[model samples]
Target: MITYSNLGKKGNLGNQLFQIASTIGIAEKNQQEYCFPFWEYSEYFEFQFKECSSVENWTSLREKAFNYYDWEVSHGNFDLNGWLQSERYFSQSINKNLFQFKSDFEIGLLDKYHYLFARKTILVTVRRGDFVNNPNYFQLSYKFYLTALLHQFNNLQEYNIIFTSDSISYCKKHFSFLPNVFFLENLKPIEQLCLGSKFDHYIVSNSTFSWWMAWLGEKKETKIIRPMKIFDGEYSKKNDESDYFPKRWIEHNENEFKLENRYWKLKVYGYFYALQSKIQYDLKRQKKIIKNKIKDIIGYK
Candidate 1:
């Protein structure tokens, strides 16, 4: 039997789904009976695997397994931890079966937004909550989004840009001026995931939540734009260590391109760049202050 403990690990909805998907992938590959022990947050998602089962004694089994084998070597041997994120190990067929929305509310929301799916839609996932406040995480500038949008769609007026985010207010405050921009608010995490998967194209933020959403719906025709850096200045140098970004997706780097012999256009581009930098700096500071206040209020050390 193949089983893993899902206790005491504080993870977002995306990571939890990935864990379950990884287990399903491993079980199919190894032809083992897979079981995922329930955690507090398991009820938030609906997962089903024909050969998989759940048990209450997940913690006890996990402890016994750890005591019997070297934790690092044994865990890595099965390729359990990295399978979901790695392109080499990921099985789309298995994952598609594992993650499904069980709630009627979530399924209804997907149907409500079916009109967007029928049209030429570009899903833009902007992660704000903890990513903006945390220095360790990579937060892409609005300029990156602009660059990617301009690169992908020469005529932005033709397609609908659907913005889904943790902070809808933040998206509206910054991106409301853009043409064809629309926001979907007050959605459950699973609902957001389902909605995002239906889009024709994706402009994803440097967060695992956005990554999973893009991965779920990826197709031969699908175009995905991802940030080149996944962390701040010094930390971003280590991006080569992980196989997070798929080969087919476009990676948008932060470097400025020089416009040759177009003096007027160069000046205009420089002005926009300067303005974007200032706005990004201010937003980062504000988010950090807000995060600190919340942490203090919650007495989180």
Candidate 2:
């Protein structure tokens, strides 16, 4: 069975995407042995690490499995691309397309149910890519976004901002502005039930879970807010829409927040990539230096 760990180095949602893609890919291969979640554990890696060591040998193997997303299937044990090219992956993509057809399917589902619901429905999603490699990065990051959003939309109404986050405990602890906002552990189940009805507007962090939710939501004229920059910096409306909004909703970056990697995984990866580039550059420089020294020593052109 194929298993994944810290998919994209993020939590549940990240892992879910990887699982969906991999499941489709493996199913295409007609290899019944290929199964996702051979074991289902809820705790994060650190929490689960000490308790579960039975599958320790599969760590490197799983990384090789996900590399197929980038088409780098050079892993000796398996042909990742071949698996992705299989019928299942393409079929899954097609299913998603059809599923998205609801965006144009008459009156929006949100209006149907949540239009006059006493509690205001605010779609909340958090992004912590910078914190994916860091510990509790999303925790701190979510608090920042949650507070900012509440303050920005303070006068909206007596609202209930239904938040979706991967970190349940963090949400429970930080977001206690009762009668105002609440947190849902994950949006996957919400996405399933909300085939028609969902949030009125989406206040999304730099996270893919919210991006897809807002995209899939059947709300017309929903206010979709995102961070000014993906992890940092800034972006134009077009880029933001293309990157975050999958449907006709407006994509606006109302806030700009710094990228915080509480665990420093992002920083670590950045340094890793930068170091690799510098090493290559230095190697070339050294080669040039050696060639010049040889020419000078031999007195040749």
Candidate 3:
């Protein structure tokens, strides 16, 4: 049997797929086999072996496969030259050679958390560096989300919100005021201990770091919420989908807490690390406009 782990962005889409794959036991068979598209137009996919003759079976089998699903705008046409080339390449190669268990065992693992949090509890996750210009955006979102969650889950008295990310220090600096949210400064160690458990409703930011939290917390019907828009521009507003969540699970957005448009324009340069391609696009458009103005001043060549 094969068990594979996710190496994608740590939020909703990644988390949902991870839960589906783990529950289905698709990653254990060929742990080493994996693939990710490098082209800007390519679709993303996750695959792992279900069974094999030996661990070395995939020595000759290439893991490359095409996936055409386009759920997020970020996955649309992008300039590969603008991406964090090194990190993108590295993330593509991430594959875990772990064991696969029956779906029953997977449910059992998730049950550990259910048993621990016997009382009603709300589990919220925040990703660090989601909004570089408005550092407080996620902080505010968490506050509003927590408030709404408490209101919805009337009996949810105990709140155990866990925050996990690459930059726990940064997240801590901004979100220290929350009353009872459990903040794990670093995620790697916690992942080893919990082995993916604990969490009820996952309030994920735009980052994929929280994907595993939602995936591993699926035993008790987890609700995963993410942003309708990651960047600021005309968002093409429409009806909110918070009402579409499962009864046992709910996905609500704190769009009311979204940062103002003025602040978003101020974010053109500082987000190179977070939204690299978009930054490059911004720079390119700026350069083109500059060139056109120069031509107007000096008379075109």
Lowest lDDT block of 10, candidate 2: 44-53
lDDT of 3 by residue, 1-301 (tens): 2212222332343433443333232222223233322212112222343332233332221122211111111221211111110111122223221223344544655564454355444445555443543422333333344444544454543665555655666446444555455555433433322433355666655443344444445664555664543333332123222222223434355544444455343334324434664476567768989999999999997
Cα lDDT for residue 218, candidate 3:
62
lDDT of model 1 at position 123: 86
- Per-residue error for 208 in candidate 2, Å, reads 1.9
Descending-lDDT candidate ranking: 1, 2, 3
Which parts of model 3 are misplaced by more than 4 Å? 1-121, 130-152, 170-179, 189-196, 230-249, 257-301
Off by over 4 Å in 1: 39-84, 100-107, 233-241, 257-301
lDDT by residue for model 2 (159-253), tens: 66665665655455445544566565433443433431356677766555555566556455666665544432232322222322333443343
What value of lDDT does candidate 3 attain over all alpha carbons?
A: 0.40
Error of 2 at 261 (Å): 26
As for lDDT, the candidate ahead, 1 or 3, is 1
In candidate 1, which residue pairs clash? none
